[model samples]
Target: MSIVTGSLFALALAASPATPAPPKPATTTLAPGVTLLRGEFVPGRQPDGNTIVVDAPQGLIVFDTGRHAEHAQAVLDLAKARGKPIAAIVNSHWHLDHVGGNVKLRAAFPEAKVYATGAIDAALGGFLASYRRQLAQAIDMAASDPKKQDGYRAELALIDAGERLQPTERIAASGPRDIAGRRVELQVVAPAVTGGDLTLFDTVTRTLFAGDLVTLPAPLFDTACPARWSAALAALDASDFKRLVPGHGAPMPHEQLSQYRRAFDGLLACAASKRAAAECTAGWIADAGALIPDAEQAFARTLVDYYVGNVLRGDASRLEANCAAPNDLH
Candidate 1:
């Protein structure tokens, strides 16, 4: 399968029965100064990413704004409840699920400066343009069904009007940065999750905000470089962070991270050996152990298909090349 074929498959998947949108985001306190805004990414639904908020001495710092306006509002409410103004917003990657609420959040807190890896600009301009077109077609198909019309219309409006906020501070490289009186180490892992993947470590809380670099149940292999992604996971496993917050799942401990890494490694090895998609998927299923519950079997299979067809079968060099150059996906 090529990139074009993978993209078409993705669009076809999107046009299928709409997955249910997540309810209000739930909050989890990771540490004294760290709070996680957990969101859901149902395989076929309105997938929104997770957000992490840190209450520093100067003000509040947010990691990723989530996919929906309501999700972003939930984060804003949490910040208000903490009685700290949002001083900065750090986007982990260019995916809409991670950075969709950036514009609204920035409008709410004008003082908050947005930060992201510079490569996100190209993703927003290229890959996302194609994504928007596919999403519009999906919405149009859904609109014909009275039962799904309302939901599809709402999503369409969001796609048409939602602003893609540009990063005020483009991180050209990874290094230590001070935000709101707290020291943060930003690591830019390229051609992994996307062109520019920004992972953050909060020295104060000992937590790692791993964007799409690490996900539970199964990884979203869309627009990923398998080799680089595996390496990134290995680096995360070796890190000193006490807890890891993934882009779309619950916060994980080191043990869970290990499980994910093993599964990912198995899948990659199977693919690299010129195995069939079914073989790779089966290998991952075995390596994943009990992570895939009976109810989530369908979701797991979808992700596996995506990984094998999109990430594995596609040309690795082409994927890497497109990361630097603007994708003509549209």
Candidate 2:
């Protein structure tokens, strides 16, 4: 089987027999000629862990390292074990979970060029500045609530310990780049997922690395503009890709992505309609948890929180007020 297909097989085997299943041998073939090393990060499974290392001809290219130097080391080890040299590292966005290992990766592969979109560069700038601001706040709050004081100190420590990921040094032009025998095409689908989210496409294997662009359990729109994100999902449907490697959850069929988009669009529409009628937060929304299947009700609550906290409060609302009607196309 091809490496891509093989990789899928390995993942499937690993996923099967959830309880007491014997560990499958560490097989590197995830597909034909392509190798995917599932890193320690799987979103929803863990808040701060999600990274994947890919082995291609050009060397090792990782998609989104977790939130610390140690995570990067783990990825490097897996790559080294497979006889793959660290070549380049890329982030799907600037979220701390995605880019936390930028400093470490650069240190490990100094020759490897880090790539991100202009928007991500700007976003990183904002992130660093925000970190600084948080530090200041932490310092100011040190004398307040004891719990708050501890939180502030921890936050500051994180900022100080993390390497400053400068954009110009670590960023790249937003487009396709050939890496280790694989044609990696990076496309910015929309502002959903995150302000300048991008997905990597492997033309050779027809695989698309959808960086948090599509997630399970109804996905997360708290950090992005839902309207734009919904639009982004629509665009992804039109784009060509056979296998999708999501930033979170298991690798999914293309249709699952579309299904997720439609669900989010539906939730947003319901939220907006209520808001327009001045009854946005009525009892129905309060009971939203009961409407969806128990499997998805939790994520649905997150959507409701966004509607209330962001849209209603006008705190970080990015999508204006309209929730476009959902369509069968997603």
Candidate 3:
């Protein structure tokens, strides 16, 4: 398969498994009124995106629902514990891990209005189509083992029944929005993570809910526009928020965010020189230093290669390709 599809396939294989019972997400209170629900970082299972819950005076506001049913349940449990009804739900981007629990959250809080950028339609369409194809492949591969087959089938049923929820309140521009008596600044940074990325900055808590715009450990460049992503990161660097909540991983401080931005800038410069993918990958791995540990060096190299070959090159055909043979670039 092409580099983009292959990269996604690899990530899917690493994250998506039909575990009989998924573990609970770890929740951390970032501030007095803000809480972060972090997804488990296991190798195989329904991986979850981080969910942020904001307790507003009128009610509760949630950002980015986790991927699995259990993950969503964890967010619900937090809301129940806080004794506040969900007033609004905000989707940072359209990725499945970020938006997968939309249906469940909406079901629980029917009156909760959803707010997101208008870019979700295209993202949702692409994901559902790709996921269906991948699920079929997984089902075929599991045919030899009845237990595995049943697991795949169960996952397929959830996919078929899952509903992708669109934003009831579309965020067309960046500015201050008053939701449930809470003031939030919605910053639109598109073609960075996805075409519909919306970064929320809480005026009260000074917390920046940066979707996939600022990932820890390693950034996912699968659907990124290198230049635009870099520009988005630069903008985030200029923001006044004190605490940063990424789409995945734990909440970090400004210093850590700056560190990630520097690495990203260096990688972009390396790719811009039109160097060999391997050469660029090595340079990035070297520049990243301890940011990428020795154990994850191989994976980091593969990601760098994908960024250079697909993202910087502007060659997205790989994302739509259906090659029978794996690229094995990793």
Candidate 4:
């Protein structure tokens, strides 16, 4: 998941660049004052995480901007339409799809502060740096594919983007922090989904933004340690939030989150057992039953199969690559 082409969702967006244009990000009202700019997961374009905009007393607080320009623009558009200033930007993780719009948003709101974990610093030098080199080699080898070249270049541009992409404020530990005149809980669950991941809890709405920790259809394990990630999910389940917003998919009630946890735990268990990978995949597809809508069941199946074969049961250290050491995987 460190690389752009990491997951099936990533491949769904990156594998080919000649598909139909993706529709603009859709804006939805998750609650009274919380608005969600749902990131587009269209066939041919890079996917973006759902951006949440909160109406703070001072200005708007944006959580997790999308990967593409148009998606970020939708966030900007939402702010403009409301006639408010963006006071703060909260990034859930270091993923380009989540933080790519930092510069774009900061350009418009120079005073806005970006808050996130410090994981991106090391990631830039290691994971993302490796990704940059891979893109360059792929672009060179794709001389005959102009459209593919364009797609690569677009992602490359984000890599070389402005310093605004870096966070101005660090969320080092789980605590209540005052952001844009609103108090929210920011949890630093590292070595779970990435080197650093932030899950925001809005005390006002009693809603927890679980980031990619609870992504629907199938959980992404590209940059995750299965054991550590399972613990992180436990932490979320223990939190006193009524509703949860995942990085992808719709906001769900606590019961639905429990379902996701069940599926994720089951997937890990199956992967650890001696059963066939197909059984593991089938377990995931079945465990994630209602979470994977009929329209997305096919996609969920494909992703789960890949996870079983290449990730969950693949290499010993692969899951702990982002962790500090393998001794403390759990």
- How well is each residue in 38-145 modelled by candidate 3, as lDDT tens digits? 865443444578899999978999998977788889988988998899888999876667877888888898999889876666543555556667778887986766
Better of 3 and 4 by lDDT: 4
What 10-residue stretch in candidate 3 is worst by lDDT? 321-330
| Lowest lDDT block of 10, candidate 1 | 1-10
Candidate 3 contains a number of clashing pairs equal to 0
Per-residue lDDT tens digits of candidate 4, residues 157-208? 8888836678998777779999999989888887788888889999999989
Off by over 4 Å in 4: 1-5, 8-14, 42-44, 325-330
Better of 2 and 4 by TM-score: 4
TM-score list, all predictions:
0.87, 0.68, 0.83, 0.93
- The local lDDT score (0 to 100) that residue 214 gets in candidate 4 is 86
Q: How do all the candidates rank in terms of lDDT, highest first?
A: 4, 1, 3, 2
| Candidates sorted by TM-score, best first | 4, 1, 3, 2
In model 3, the runs with Cα more than 4 Å from the true position are 1-6, 14-21, 146-164, 274-330
What TM-score does model 2 achieve against the real structure?
0.68
Q: What is the C-alpha lDDT profile of model 2 across 250-295, one tens digit per residue?
A: 5656776666666656556666553542233333234332233555
Residue 22 lDDT (model 4): 50
* Overall local distance difference test of candidate 2: 0.54
**How much RMSD separates candidate 4 from the native structure?**
2.9
Candidate 1 residue pairs in clash (backbone atoms < 3 Å): none
TM-score of 3: 0.83
